[model samples]
Structure formats: structure tokens, C-alpha cells
Target: MAEIIGVIEQLWRYPVKSTGGERLDSVEVDERGLAGDRLYAVRDSAGKLGSGKNTRRFRRMDGLLRLSSRLGHRLDGPELFDPLGRPVADPTAFLRAYLQRPDVALAREDAVSHFDQLPVSVLTTATLDWVRGAAPAAVVDVRRFRPNILLRTPPGTPPFVEDGWFGREGGGGARLAFVRASERCAMTTVAQPGLPHAPEILKAIIQAHEGRLDALAEVVTPGRLSVGDELSLN
Candidate 1:
């Protein structure tokens, strides 16, 4: 029998890579992961992927942090929203002005999602609480972590319990196997909207949790995932 672990607290979909994502009440999950998640990416002059993390050719592009998008025409791709949450027809020009990079362009993902590692990621409330406890002075919001699913673990469940869910099945038929603990980066420390720039927040993660606050998951069984759905370990 499967044991009840937690309820899905929030659902998010990033239609464009390395940009602010939007919350959803419920979502469809396919093999590639959430529908309309990371289907678009910012391409630089040299055609390098513009990632939030400052990793090599994937330059750190924080300007996109204040922006978001929604699924527009299936053939045309996502329609981007401005920093003020207003939709813009020409996303490339809008983003260029925001990032001050005229050479950059918004392009659709070729064959797969532009996910950093795995297509899906989950973060437990317990883990967020740990970060807050570790850095009480800094604001702790789920947006910093950018997880596809935010789970509210049962009360009294210890933090980092997600680490143990590796190689487990959850809900009705969605099987998840942890690729590895997600590595923290400077992106989490960046300020965006309600979040403040707090370098110590990432420091605490490194000191206490080895710089990982969430876990990446790969779907073995495709199914619908919702805000109230309960997760279980198989």
C-alpha cells in the first residue's frame, strides 16, 4: 500500500526558459513534463542559450527575471509578458530593451524542453522552511527555487524529506526518480519582485544542505497533476 506523504501546494509552468514563470491551479503532465513548460529560450547573437545561471556559454540573463509568458498560438509559441505583467506581441524586441541586448532573440525549443537537467522538479514546504530558519533575515519565497511543483508535506515531516523519495512512485501512476539534489546558484540569490537580494540565503543552503534546496524528477508514468493531489512513495 502507498502511504500518503503530502499534497501538491502549488503548480507552475515556465513557458519560456530562464524567465519568471506563472502559477497554475492544475496542469497536464506529459512525458516531456508540464505542458508549455520551457518551450521557448533566449538565443544570443552566437546562438548561445540565455540561462539564469552564469554557466559558461549559457550567459546569466537576470533581466528576464521580471518577465513571464503564456501559451499563445501552438504554431507561433509563447506570448511573453512584460515586467509589469503586460503582454507584448514582439517578445524579442521587448526583451532586448529589458536586457539591453539587441543581439538576443527569443526562439522555440527544438525537440525538448530547455530544462537545466530533468524536465520536472519538486520542492517540499519543509525544505523552504529550512531555508527560512537558516536565513531568517532574508525573504524566503518559492519563486527563487523555480520548481514545477511545490508540495506541502504533512506536519512534523522533517526538512529534506524529498531526498528520500528517489526511485519512488507517487499519486496514482506518476513515477519519479530523483536525478540528484538540485545545485544552488547565484540565481536564487538575485532579487526579483517581492524577493530581496540575499547572498546569505544561498550561503545557508551551501553550509547546511550542500547548496541544494530541491530535487529534480523524471516522469516514468505520465498523468495529470493538480494542486490538491497527494503524493506517495511506492
Candidate 2:
């Protein structure tokens, strides 16, 4: 028998990598993960995707988080918007001017994945409360963590409860298998709209929790999921 753990509080989909995403009341989940999630990205001259930290496949591109993107009716890609909510007519030119990188351009994800790690990322309200308690002075917001699914656990539920779900399958409609704890990065400290520059947010996770705050997951059964759906461990 499966045990009920929590209800889905929010769903997020990032059409463009390393940018702000849109909240949804409901969304479709596929084998690739959330539909339209990270289908596009800012690519540099060296072919590295834009990200918060420099890696083998990712290049640290500052100010990418200030941008927001959403999936339009087009199947080709999502529509990019600037920090001020204005639509971008030319993504390549806009990205070049915005990031001050002459060789940077917008591109879609190909055979290689655009995700930082796993296909999905999950966070719980209990962990948020823990972070707030740990760093009372820091502004702890869900946007800083950038989870694809936000679960609202019942009262009295312990923080970091998602850690136990690793190697377990759970979801409301779309089945997901928790794989590993999502690692924190320097991106969490970057200031964005309605968020302030707070490095202490990442510091609290590192000092108290070893820099992990959420769960990274992979889709086991593709389906539709909605806010308020009950989640259980199977």
C-alpha cells in the first residue's frame, strides 16, 4: 500500500534554461520530463549552454536569471522575455547585448540534454521552513531553489523528508522516481525580481545540510499532474 505524504502545491516549467519559469495549475509530464521545460537555451561560441556555474557543458552567463521564458503555441521553441516583461524579437541579438557576449546566441536543445542534472527537481515546504529557521535574516523563496514541483507536506513533517524518498516512486498522476538530492549552487544567491542578493541562503544549506535542499527526480510514468493532487510513495 502506498502512503500519502503530501499535496502538490505548485508546478513550474522553464522553457529556457537558466531563466525564470512560469507557474502552472496543471502540466503534462513526458519521458523527457515536463513538456516545454528547458527546450531552449542560450548557447555560447564554444557551444556551452548558459548556466550559473561553468561546467564541461555549461558556461556561467551572468544576468540570464533576470530573463523569463514561456512556451507559446509554437512547437519550435518558447518565447523569451526580458527582465521588464517585454518580449524579445531577436533572441540572438538580445542575448548578445544583455550578456555582453558577442558570440552568444539562443539555441534549442538537441540530442544532448539541457538540464543541469536530472529531468525533474522537487522541493518541499518543510525544507523551506527549515531554511528560514536556519537563516533568519535571509530571504528564502521558492524561486531561489527553482523546483519543478513544490510539495506541501502536512504539519509536523520533518524537514528534508524528500531525502528518504530516494529510490522510491511517487506522484499524483505522473509517476516519478526520486533519484538524488538536488545540489545547491551559486545561482541561489543571485538577485532576481522581487529577490535580493543573499549568499546566506546557500550558506545555510551548506553549513547545516551539506548544500542540498531538494530532490532530483526522473519520470517513471508519463501523465498529467495538477496542483492540489495528492502525492504518495509507492
Tell me the TM-score of model 2. Answer: 0.97
Ten contiguous residues with the weakest lDDT in model 2: 71-80
Winning model by lDDT: 2
lDDT of each: 0.81, 0.90
lDDT (0-100) at residue 34 of candidate 2?
A: 90
Backbone clashes in model 2, listed as residue pairs: none
Q: Which runs of model 2 end up more than 4 angstroms from their true locations?
A: 72-74
User: How would you encode candidate 2's per-residue C-alpha lDDT over 172-229 as one tens digit per residue?
Assistant: 8999999999789989999988888999889889998889879999999999999999
RMSD of each candidate? Answer: 1.9, 1.1
List candidate 1 stretches off by more than 4 Å.
Answer: 72-76, 111-113
> On residues 33-67, what C-alpha lDDT tens digit does candidate 1 reach at each position?
88788888998887677887665447778777777
